[model samples]
Target chain A: MNDSMSTRDSLALAELVELQDVSAVAFSGQRLKPGRGSNLQLSVAAGFALTEQALSYKFDLDGSLVDVDENDPLVQLSLSLVVTYVPRNANAENWVGGDHERLKAFGDSFAWPAAYPFVREGVTAILSRLGADAYQLPMLRPSDLL
Target chain B: MRSLYERVTATLKGARAVAAARLRHEVLALLHQAQLASRMTQSDVARELGVRRSAANQVFRGDGNIRTNTLAEYLHAMGFEADLRLVRAGEPRQAALEQRAVRPAFEDWRIRRPQPTTSGVFVTNEGDDRPVLVRWAATGRTESFRVEAEVTTLPAANSFTPLGKRMFTT
Candidate 1:
């Protein structure tokens, strides 16, 4: 993994992170996780569940009202941001290929900045940016959800 | 309120329908032009392709699944190449809208006659500006109209039976 971020790429990533922070503050009124992946999960204080994807954000506010053993809120809103990066090599083999690892690292690094804003500020900033309800919760790691 | 899943499903269905209809229309138009240029009887072409006359008719009617290879063979037999390209969004919608606008007026002027069963001349008037004669066939039909106000020289018709002979002679 080359792991070298150009000045322009670094600045763009920083801006995306800032936007995520602003969104979290505006919506959930609480910051959950500052660094997460696209599969970041949240159990908001407002009884809503939040899940992030690549294309769009989804909100499952209804899950909050249900009484269950885990009692965690359902995902109410999901915010998806478009993140694009070229793989280090085009002809990398399947899962065991070095090129595949490089590509995954590249995507993870680019996605980090956007994930930061969400985690640091929480859902309030996100909902506020979207002119929606507040989301209060801690960020759920991708591994935990899986 | 509709769920997110409903919205995405509807979008996918709408896109698929539009694509299928456009493909059908394009294939029909190409076959129609090829048949007209070839000047071979539909039955003859059907025999050559080892298909029924109704199948040939369906080719013009834009019904039936046409394998790409079969369509290519048909086009090659007619001395034409089959080419397809993606249609941009703007033009198809504009064409559809124009067709819809003209359809009602055309229908109002159309004279409904008994469906013709064989190749023959038919004349009918439903308050038309001129007298029209239509040549009817099971596969397709052609129409010609004569206006009282017009005096123009008509081109002599050429006798072209089989397409292969016509091409080599020309």
Candidate 2:
């Protein structure tokens, strides 16, 4: 067996990890409504989670032969963001059930993309109202990072 | 009435969309703030990042659906390092065991604890021995100590120890 090649292969295997999906999410913040002139502020926080198998692959760089599963993800990452919206003139509307679900799905496989537009549109609308067009965020694709 | 599966699926979809939107807003807002603070025009950023001015503009406008690497590069140009932290949430027992087994005793330096949001993020001073402190938000539980600072080149091939002895340990 070629010792160097074996080590190289093992390291490559470790690097060949993929992002599966947002396993879970928890966030705290309020919703910004359309048609209301409001100032919005947000803080984005992200975290990472790794399985035991993935951990083994990372530190066990001794070129030792070990079982490798292509289908399993070595790590899971969680992104939590909180957006605070202050209305310029008017009391805030009552919070509803959909808000909780909105936060939960932020980490879900199917719902993340669907919810992106709402925030974008909200920002655009509010900024347009304020006559400030300078702020914008780059669109991010989760799969590409994997 | 909708089927249970159908309802659950719809709800999940709604939640995902909202969460994604919020994340997008936060990221864009931060980038915008960074751009203002740096006072570097889109062209300036493009030159530094080696992209076209138009491409830099697209990123600023939030039109680019950026990949993680691209985002890291953008942040790097602006003098910030993107650090994503992942901590095992449910497995307290496993976390404890790993913590005890892996961490080395060090006094002068300590691994920055993961924040309520994310932790162990550092900005490079751009010194010769730019101490790189890597915390595995996903995998590695241990943070390293900086025993000493030495000059070395990163290997392109299969050399066992990579970048031997820098200002910081990883």
Per-model DockQ against the true two-chain complex? 0.00, 0.01
lDDT score at residue B69, model 1, on the 0-100 scale: 78
Docking category of candidate 2: incorrect
- In terms of DockQ, the best-performing candidate is 2
- The chain B TM-scores of all candidates, as shown, are 0.45, 0.44
Looking at model 1 chain A, report the run of 10 residues with the lowest lDDT sum. A47-56
lDDT for B14 in candidate 2 is 59
Native contacts present in each candidate (fraction):
0.00, 0.00
| Residue A42 in candidate 2, Cα distance off native in Å | 52
Candidate lDDT values, in order: 0.39, 0.37
Q: Kindly report the docking quality category of candidate 1.
A: incorrect
Q: Could you give the interface RMSD of each candidate, to one decimal?
A: 37.1, 17.1
